[model samples]
Target: MTGPIWLQWFYVLFWIALISLMAIGGYFMFRKFLKALPKADGKSILDWQEYYIKETLHLWTDEHKALLNDLVSPVPELFRDVAKQTIAGKIGELVVKEEAKQLSQDHIIRGYILATPKRDHKFLIKKLKERNIDISPYQELLK
Candidate 1:
């Protein structure tokens, strides 16, 4: 009692369809898993910037480090917090004075320098000056 030829063919086709569907589903699932995984290199923009700043600081001469320390030291208590904002503004002023352009013209570098601790404002200004950034316009801010 063999099955009808047509029935046998139907069974074969049905199994083929099921297995094909399973393979397709598995492929899609694997793709989704890969998409969920983090990038292989794993370094982000912030991580790169932090590395750059650390390397830059590490290469500074002792004189440069001392100058930076002097620049960032805390102001009087009354101006401590406000000083950061003031220094950031002073940076913008310096950029405009030297380049004849707004700080927004080089927002990334401006933002990076401005993100430093308030005490390091002078350090950032000095680094800019070393690059021929001309901080004379903002010198009054350091007073």
Candidate 2:
């Protein structure tokens, strides 16, 4: 049983070294494979915001569409053709800044409702109530 203890220890060390090398090789190969994979087009955050808004507009309520249109209505004439989503993205940024203390849902709803014109206040309030939004905080604005 003790014929060659040193030889046994050498074999164990050799096996451990071989396994480690294999693992390292596999890791490098995985890295190389990942590097070869195609990357997503380099869209900016604003671009992504625009794309999402454009794509999802169809799903929005009529009130949402009107609100978005109102939000972008003040753009300079030269850039009028700019995508609605781009304008919406800017409004979203402003809303987030203006209502930093509120929950995201509240801020988004309040921002859109607030931006809506006084003429549309009753319509906006009605739409929000239809959607089951809590309009208690915005009652004064709706008045």
Candidate 3:
């Protein structure tokens, strides 16, 4: 309150700039930390996902891939790629588990549901219903 008008504005701007920089720096640091942390069976989450995807790449038919894209369409463009990859990774895991000959609609639906956060189940349910896909088989997962 005792400072000149210019000094007061400068103080405000300086704090704003400092906080912005700190937030940006923290975000990058957190991303690096996540990438370093080990997940499933000592593999980092990224590595685990990559392994599943690579192992099942041959099984992802064009139709199955398109369905996956449709399932994640509700996600914002900014996060769609990550969402798609995560869902695909989950789907890949399911395919491997079942020893499936090829990707199926059921596998796609189950994987999308499993990979999505619980809070977003409503959106998923709506998407499935819109596509005329039966939700009865996956009721347990929606809950």
Candidate 4:
């Protein structure tokens, strides 16, 4: 109340800018921290995901790739690639576990369902239905 109007505005703007920068820095640091953290299996989560995806990259047909792109279409553009990679990695893990010779539509659908969180199951169901993929087989997983 004692200072000039301009000085008061400058003080408020300075604090706002400082807080914003701190928040941005904190976000980056948190991401770096997560990337370094090891998972229960000894490898960092990102490393495992990359390994699974690379292991089965040769098996993914054009159709399978297209289907994954379609499934991730609803995600925002900024995060779409990460979403695709995560889902693809999960699918690859499934294929490896089963020692399957080739990827199938069933594998893709099941992987998508499992990769997504439970809170998003409704969206998953709607998306799968839109593609005309049966959800009956995954009813238990969804719950």
User: Backbone collision count in every prediction?
Assistant: 1, 0, 0, 0
Leading candidate by lDDT: 3
lDDT of each: 0.51, 0.58, 0.89, 0.88
**How much lDDT does candidate 4 score?**
0.88
Q: What is the C-alpha RMSD of each candidate to the true structure, in Å?
A: 19.9, 18.7, 2.8, 2.8
Quote the RMSD, in angstroms, for model 3: 2.8
Positional deviation of residue 85's Cα in model 4 after best superposition, in angstroms: 0.8
Collision count of model 1: 1
Off by over 4 Å in 3: 1-32
lDDT of 3 by residue, 1-143 (tens): 58899998999999999999999999978986897699767988778789899999988878888888887888999889988988988988999989998888999899998999998889888988898988999999888
Superposed model 4: Cα runs more than 4 Å off: 1-32
Q: In model 4, how large is the Cα lDDT of residue 40?
A: 86
Better of 1 and 4 by lDDT: 4
By the TM-score metric, which is better: model 1 or model 2? Answer: 2
| TM-score for each predicted model, relative to the true structure | 0.28, 0.34, 0.81, 0.80
Model 2 segments beyond 4 Å from truth? 1-91, 95-103
**Candidate 2 structure quality by residue, lDDT tens digits, 2-113:** 6598998999999999999999999978865664455587665546556545544444556656655554455556654453544455445554456433224454455555
Best by TM-score: 3
**lDDT (10s digit) by residue, model 1, range 1-143:** 88899999999999999999999999978865664455557854334434444433333456543443444454566654444344344444444446533223243234435545546666666666665766665454444
